[model samples]
Target: MADLKKTELEERAFETAKTLLAKYQNPHNLKLEENSNLEDCYTILITLLYAEILEETEQLAILSIIDGMKLLDGNR
Candidate 1:
């Protein structure tokens, strides 16, 4: 899905995830602004891919962010 086109919101969420993942070594330190779409994206990502975050898999929390877009897109 690397070549898949991402909407602006998706891109924002992806970037946010990457930034947060990079700033903190542990997922527990990550925080999202509540009651916003960005937070919603993070919620989906965490719910679906928390294990990956906990494992620090591939150093790419962006994967979860991308996958979270699928859930959001499906709802739309």
Candidate 2:
């Protein structure tokens, strides 16, 4: 079965990423800001939540995060 909560969080993170990507122009600064949003946006919030789950505790969660990031990149 699919992990619906994880999927929903991914969507929220993607949306937050979209908004940040639109407002920021520099890649360096964008990454910095995005990192900061971990305290403020769903992107970081969701990842942090998932990161705590035993299933996502593995390093491959990094890949999952990257894939979610691609969704933002592809849309923009």
Candidate 3:
């Protein structure tokens, strides 16, 4: 049961990331140089897009807080 839930969550995250990548990579939205390598562009774009999403969602902030708490506890 837990495994099924984890799998579903993973799938949803993957689909969301794919959608984000497609949106950023849409030729109509993004202009590139003729010599640009699309594969490299995509790799960079996806990393940036995911980081944007994490920041926008405040997930990164929450994770940072959690890590801070762990560090403080460990020092005690």
In candidate 2, position 17 carries an lDDT of: 51
- Per-residue CA lDDT of model 1 for 1-76, tens digit only, reads 4655656766667566565555446535444443345666566456435544344563355565566667877999
CA displacement after TM-score superposition, residue 34 of candidate 1 (Å): 24
Displacement of residue 31 (Cα, Å) in model 1 is 15
After aligning candidate 3 to the native by TM-score, how far in Å is the CA of 6 from where it should be?
A: 7.6
All candidates: CA RMSD in angstroms? 11.4, 12.6, 11.5
User: What is the lDDT, from 0 to 100, of the residue 37 in candidate 2?
Assistant: 35
TM-score, per-candidate, Cα-based = 0.35, 0.29, 0.30
Candidate 2: give the clashing pairs: none
Question: Can you rank all candidates by lDDT, best first?
Answer: 1, 2, 3
Clashes of each: 0, 0, 0
Please report, as a residue range, the 10-residue window in candidate 1 with the lowest summed lDDT. Answer: 27-36
lDDT of 1 at 44: 42
Deviating ranges (above 4 Å) for candidate 3: 1-6, 26-46, 50-76
lDDT of 3 by residue, 1-76 (tens): 3433323323333444454555554543443333334343444345545555444554443344345445656999
Top TM-score model: 1
* Residue pairs in candidate 1 whose N, alpha carbon or C atoms collide under 3 angstroms: none
